[model samples]
Target: MSIRARLLSTIAGQLGNPHGTLGKGVAFMLNRSNHRAIAGAVEATGVTAGATVADIGFGGGAGLSLLLERVGANGSVHGFEISPDMLSRARSRFAGEIGTGRLQLAEGPMTGLPLADNALDAAITVNTMYFVPNLDAACTELVRIVRTGGSLVVGIGDPDAMAKMPFTAYGFTLRPVAEVIAALERAGCTVDHQQLANPPIPHHLLVARPA
Candidate 1:
């Protein structure tokens, strides 16, 4: 691979599952850069007090933090991330909330979230779809984790815009928004699509619920 490819691969790997000292830095950047997607995705879920919600692929824990706050003292939040480093950071940062049973964290694969069927009042995932190896399982699992009237929010950058990034050349699957909506629909969801941001990223947020 060329030096550029090598760099792209390294960044791509870190983005997929952050780790070690360098990952610490990536985690910080993600928290700052992905705030809009994270916050909007959570809001799309309509999360409320006393409800149980989860932030899948919680990245730098920004989404997890938002969920924790929205769920409040009475509610609970479950966070699932594939990155051990990020999970450790979250565990440390939200120790008090975790100790009080207001937050739960898990490091695992996207295919299986370690959650019971219909366990969540709502769920949100931001910019993590491209890394999922199995789109079928990803779609199925998102719906499986949330109850029939419960909501799910998926956030991602437009495929055209994401294709502009070199890192996407390695291990990233640039899927069209329609393809994702179709997959979710097959899993029994009614998707509502809206552009969350344009130009630079062409970000989108898809809110869905069971038919």
Candidate 2:
């Protein structure tokens, strides 16, 4: 395998197999300040205790689990992952929730969500926008699935920080935050909140409401 594939495999393995020997360490590391910042950004989008939610690119299922906790049993959480390996890992990690019907793991891109229009209360994506080749289409899909007044929160590494990272080696492009926000606005979403957080990594969070 190539170096990029190997690196991603290592990261995914560490995250997906939380019951594996490395799972505890990975979980612990995720609960630290940096991950907390990402989680907080998602929460700031206004997900409530009984809101149906979707977490796009739910790597290792960490953010999905966090969202589930916020929404509790009254709500349902759906996780969309394009990576087969990552989805497998997430399924294993949240087996209980999946089995009980509280969480749904869908294997596909957010561009073609298997959901009805205005079906969700909130949706969040973290550190995954860089992989989307078409920002406008993705934003439209996000807004289409969420109800009016629903929230769509997207978190991505700051372009400047991503430009300096090793992510380029893994095929990640550093997309400008302004471009993302503009695309969302053009797609008919009202800009509700935008902020940058500097922690484990420098990232930008954009929250919008369906118009």
lDDT of 1: 0.89
What does candidate 2's lDDT look like per residue over 1-211, in tens digits?
8878887666554543334556556655644634755686667767878889998777656688788898999889999877666667778888999998989988768689888899999988877776777889999998999999888888777788767655354556577788999989998887755555576666677888888
Clash count, candidate 2:
0
> How many Å off is the CA of 108 in candidate 2?
1.2
For each of the candidates, give the backbone clash count. Answer: 0, 0
- Candidate 2 at 13: error in angstroms? 13
- Return model 1's CA RMSD, one decimal: 1.2
Best by TM-score: 1
lDDT, residue 30, candidate 1: 91
Total clashing pairs in model 1: 0
Query: In candidate 1, which residue ranges exceed 4 Å CA deviation?
Result: 198-200
Error of 1 at 89 (Å): 1.1
lDDT of all predictions, in order shown?
0.89, 0.76
